[model samples]
Target: MYESFYGFTSKPFQLNPDPSFYYGSRGHRRAMAYLEYGLHQSEGFIVITGDVGAGKTTLVRSLLQRLDSSKVVAAHLVSTQIDADDILRLVAAAFGLPAKNVEKADLLLQLETFLVKLTAAGKRALLIVDEAQNLTPRAVEELRMLSNFQLEDHALLQSFLVGQPEFRQTMQSEHMQQLRQRVIASYHLGPLDLAETRAYVEHRLGCVGWKGDPRIEASAFDVIHAASGGIPRRINTLCDRVLLAGFLSEKHGLTASDVDNVVTEMREESGPERSVTPINAMPGLDSSALARLMADPAAARRLAEVAAGYQASRLEARVEQLEKVICALLGLGANTTDGADQDKERRHAG
Candidate 1:
């Protein structure tokens, strides 16, 4: 709705990861370099860990977008908490190989055959496992086993493991020593700094043709960066709503006050406090325990992941309601556009 009002060619702050919006902050640049280095080596695993919403998937997508199809065939798999057996099937399916009902032995053979064919064609196979934290040790071990595929002294497959930060703990455990030994490169993507946050917002807007209309004040970016903690996805979420507020008020510019009001309204409506009474009490989260949980990195990442999943489930419902309201407002706007419709139609009919 705001896109039309703002004369934007696209929704600049969409949640979906788009390579076109990839901003090269210092950390992201380093992470990208590590991924590229892994590509050049063409073997083993490359591990990338980041906090939730720190833009790992966006980084992966950007890499995929730049890949030369003639040299690399990449398969992306978003994992859940599956086991060793299921992980094999998921990998097979990701590469477009039939994985149904086949025994583990056949599955391994099939995958090896496919990889060998790709190697023969002068293209190496790249498997990108996203949400790697959800994998069981055995599942991750199975992934490591796949890296053993070789022909004529050349490895047939390479893997990239991308996940929330806790996955680093899992990867460093005793049982994972072999996998760790195989890692050629690894990087942790950190959130953007305040300065980069400001640039990121403008960069996204510029991508969709923003030309100073509905100008965001310098102070507004301060509010945004603080609210988002310099996380890209959170920044996108808040900026999207801030722009909506501007569009609703028909304002030519947005200032810190405008941003603050939207942030306040959003907290009241959607913050975890809305369910805290039940979440903290009925669900058995005492104050001390809650604090401890938040302090623990693994627990915090799990909570955030679960909360994000719950929020995503509600997105479709929200989109439907928003669309209905927008359509209604559009009909009303059409009627009121020029004094309840032009009289030219009636004159022409007469």
Candidate 2:
């Protein structure tokens, strides 16, 4: 709905991880270097850990985009809750190999043969597994065995394991010691800083061809940065929703108040207390917790403002309704250029 108004070619803040929209902030740059170094070395497992909404997947996608396909064979996999055998099968399937009903020995042999072929062709094979925190101890051990497949000088196959911070905790387990030993490179992708957070939002908007008077106000970014803690996914969600709020009000430029509404709305929907929860009541909070919460006066005001308007009986329902409306509007905005006609089918049906 706001795409043309904003002069964007597409929705700038869509949650989907698109490499084209990736903003290589300092932390992201370091993470990308870690991934690139791992690939360049043709080493064993390279592990990347970050919080849920951090840009690990985006970093991976960026690396894939720049990789020389002619000399690099890459496979990506998600949904990694399987057993050891299933893990190998999934890996094989990623490489377009028939994995069904294949025994472990046969699967290894097939993979080895494939690796040898790639090596002979002067190409490196890379396997990327996302959400690997779910992998069991045995599954990790099984993955470690793949590192054994190497020529005299270099590894024949490399694996990149990307997962949430819990995966790092998992790796620290005694059972994973051997696998950790085999890891040639690893990085913890951290959140963007305040400046980078602002730049990130602008970069994503620009990627989608935004050329209008910037819909997002400068003051709004401080609230966004505070609310989202510089997490890319959360930023996208909040920014996208704020745009909807602005559009609904027919505002050309977003204000801090617009961003406040979105952040407050998010908090109400995400938890019982729309404002600050007591320090002891919250888990995983440290000594700086209270200080951090109070540090951003604007964010505090936004949270308080939202909490003030939220009635216990109607909060959840209202939040859900707003979320649906916002999403529908965003979907309409996204469809304007590429698939506008296809979206018309729904209107025709209605």
lDDT of all the models against the reference? Answer: 0.77, 0.73
Question: Lowest-scoring 10 consecutive residues by lDDT in candidate 1?
Answer: 275-284
Model 1 has an lDDT value of 0.77
Q: Where is the poorest 10-residue window by lDDT in model 2?
A: 276-285
- Provide the TM-score for each candidate, comma-separated: 0.77, 0.77
- The top-ranked prediction according to lDDT is 1
- Clash pairs (backbone) in predicted model 2: 1-333, 9-208
Put down candidate 2 lDDT per residue, 1-350, tens digits, no spaces: 87776667888899889898888998888888888888878888889999887888888888989999999999998855777868899989999998999999999999999998999899999999889898887887888898799766768888899999988988999888888888988889876666677889888887887765556666667667656666788779888888877777778888766776776666668685443212121222222432344345443333323323444457444433332333343333543323433433544576
